[model samples]
Target: MKKLLLAAALMLAAATARAEDNVVKVNAPPESAVAGETAPAKASTIDCADTLGVSRVAEVDTAGGGEYGEQYPPKPLLEKGEVVLTFDDGPHPEFTRQILDALAAQCTKATFFHVGRMLKEFPDVARQVQAEGHTVGTHTHTHRNLGGASMGQAEQQIESAINIAEATLPNGVAPFFRFPYLSDPQRVRDYLAKRNIAVFGIDVDSFDWRWRKPEKVMHNVLSGLDKTGRGIILFHDIHGSTAKAIPALLAELKARGYKVVHLVPKSRIETVAVAEPTAAPAPRRRARRHRRSKR
Candidate 1:
């Protein structure tokens, strides 16, 4: 009887340990576990099981410029109907939260390239972004026209913006960047490459900044997608119209069978030596400004 009781006790202990392991697997890793970790397991926050039609694709980190200027899609490239959602120039007090809520409702994740100054002013919003499992990156200190600025000015804009973002984020910033107005200078491109930071350019511009009507903004985005097939789609969270359009836009994507791809840097960016000086490229015609209001 003593032998039998001892064996039963051992079995019970084994079962309890297995149960504990299962619990840990279901829960997110502790905060300490995420520190310095590049690819921690993400807890599923959205349930797409019932035809909302969302699916998460593999995490991708892209570098190098592409044929359409410095803008390039993900390295492995997206399949037909795959879309990577990206928002820029925000942490707008009114709209960022609304956008976040809409995204959470759909269990969708996006990459936000924030202006450094905005992150500093809205640290809570920035933290909320990271806490909810979206990738965050810098968009320059003041949303300055880096392509037209001197090398020193451009470097300051890039470096300071990154510093501010890193300081504000609980999880480290993703090693990704997007140029303001989609303008990237060759010299700036070289600097980012050496530091292992990837520069992002949009395949589809929602023109949400220019279009205040939600219906019109939604139409522009879907039309652009129709043209491009698949790539990163850009919007500005600062715009009330864009925030208002998100839910309808998400539904349209779902109805059209589009999948969302969440991007995470495969490796953290390493510190590098000072950037080399390269002659500034010839000035090009400045694009009409959407960020002027903030500046």
Candidate 2:
């Protein structure tokens, strides 16, 4: 009887240990505290069934800058449960930082598309995003809807955005671009192709912009995922709702067996030497003269 009782206790302990593997626990350091680390901790080291961290990184070669997304062809070959996290229209002052905190809490890495004006306004915040080792890309100089703009204006918008982002980021910009408002004209699409910049489209739109509440954002994402299964998921770092939505969304993703895929460019995007138009030529000359007099 003693020998049988000891064997039963051993089995119970083993079962308990096995069950604990599925319990998701989050213990993340503050974003400011993780600067010294090379990259976010790889969740692959932990059992896939256990952690809500990055599952794998997909290195993409932006050769000829092919367009991709569920809406476009040659999607990133994700398995049924894998999803890529991408954010655009950042880096906002307050909300971007909050989103970063939530993402770090899960050890997840995401791709950020920074606007030129936003980059200039919050350069320090942009640098912090880079310091955290997330992939960086440009959206446009002003987040203008390119579909309505002249080809020259579109080119200028795209080029200026990349130039500003490359100059701001320590690592330079990736050869990745996403159309603002998902409005991609064939002419602009072909232009990006010529520049060797990959175009990204959305598989699932979180619509966090419309659904300002955390629960609404979460529902939209999970429901969309239910239909699409896997692809690139879009969020905006400028919204407080998105930051609030992320933690619970990540937890739900883990519970539902969804894995996060980090996307990296095989090479950096080559920027063209195009000068941005001066907003006020007279003011610029006056400022230069004032500085010269000071000198």
Candidate 3:
């Protein structure tokens, strides 16, 4: 009977092994991609390339007056009722420095969702960001909009960016990821889950893409910051207008007694041993293999 119990436990352990052994199957797109998405694929079947465990707790109206949506109790955006401000599509040599200077002057830290290509070109800036006591994250290599992209394309974009980030950062490091163009497809979120990366969709967006006026940008930014008690704030680092507006808006936030807290999502590692470092030596180099060979 003891042997039988041991065998059963062993089977359960083996079943749990694959969940943690996910080594980011980026070169290979998930099997669902082969199913030919004649229609929008659902999130349930999309194998999470890496899972990002974000416990963003906010009140959402669900027939009832309000309900809590956080998977776990979340960190309030600020220690003292501040906002979590995040910027993406950056590592731009000049603009990033400018934003950094502004935050530094205010004695605040912010999270910069960095792009891989930009980091490769402006590695110095990436280092400076880290030095500034701010969080650094992956914004993917090509910034491909994952909303309508194939699983393969999305995987490549995400994986290559991570590879670049790991190369850019120190050892024993994995950076958080945010999708490009605010890709919020449920499948995209799931894909990140499989890979142990978090999905960060904004609770408030300034919609800077629609227009470029600095005042207009501030207005929109202020609107979101005012409404949202907490969660991620999205802004573009790719635009000159956004750069121009950020300082002014940050100043406004200060006047209104808002503090900025740099935000990073919680991961599975916090709860269970979702992943264990493989001491297994990597296999020697060989030709790239893909189930669905790309052109």
Candidate 4:
């Protein structure tokens, strides 16, 4: 009887060990499993040759709408050697598509500030930007220069842009705003603060709008980075020069040991209906110029 019990105990222990081994094999992660089903591809999977993938995503709390950029206070959004790519006035049918392809090739991400009218015209391109995991923000309707506009006009412009962007983007717009031409008036700034929309300024202006040549655009960007060390770099996706320069610029950045940081909003901005400025009352007609005309 003792011999039989001992053999029974040994068999049970062996079976338990085998079951544990099977569980590990079945449930182990892709990186560690010796035998198991293939794991699903990572959402952020990059091409095997892609080395300039986004180094990090900075999720920011934009409450109270503070300003950012080398031009604004509290330092830029990145550390030394880290760069944020931002484009403005975009969703151009041709140029924006080219830019998107370039970004995908490098597995990098960027922020695009889309003008409301442009988004309305080429909404598919704008959706592509969102689908590819880039951040979308408002650049105001018609790209109006807020500095010259009345406070009411400025608010309308800002709100209209936000509303349009929210309407167009699948995930809605980020709590980010860039003043057209970076023209931030105090009242507009205060209004943005009240709305909780964080402002984005530039550290390095690619000046692609001025430099039609891709090489020249790349050179200016590199020189700007050389000067500023690291910060948000601005480009315009509407410009063919930028579309052409993107691939080489990303490669050059990677070669120079610069890491790309993607900026994501911690919260979505609660948008409101766009307001229209009240029209001035029509002047009352003069009682009569009839007597003067008769004389």
Q: Which stretches of candidate 1 lie over 4 Å from their true place?
A: 1-47, 51-54, 62-75, 271-295
Candidate 2 deviant stretches above 4 angstroms: 1-50, 277-295
Number of clashes in model 4?
0
Could you tell which candidate, 2 or 3, scores higher by lDDT?
2
**C-alpha TM-scores of all predictions:** 0.75, 0.78, 0.61, 0.78
Q: Count the backbone clashes (under 3 Å) in each candidate.
A: 0, 0, 18, 0
lDDT measured at residue 245 in model 1 versus the true structure, 0 to 100:
96
Report the C-alpha lDDT of model 3 over 92-207, residue by residue, as the tens digit: 88878777665544445566778767877888887766655456767766565665566765666677666666667542123356666554456666666656565455666666
The global C-alpha lDDT for each of the candidates, from Candidate 1 onward, is 0.66, 0.72, 0.52, 0.72
Tens digits of per-residue lDDT, candidate 4, 51-98, equal 576676666566688788765676436778989899999889999888
In the range 1-295, model 1's lDDT, one tens digit per residue, is 6674344333323322222222111012233232221223333332334323224433333333222211443444466787888899987888987887677556566889898778878989988777655678778777777767877878877877777777778677877888877766888988887666877777777777666899988898899889877878888999898899998898888788887766556455443233322333433446454333221
CA lDDT for candidate 2: 0.72
**Predictions ranked by TM-score, top down?**
4, 2, 1, 3
True-vs-predicted CA distance for residue 89, candidate 2, Å: 0.5
Enumerate residue pairs that collide in model 1.
Answer: none
TM-score of 2: 0.78
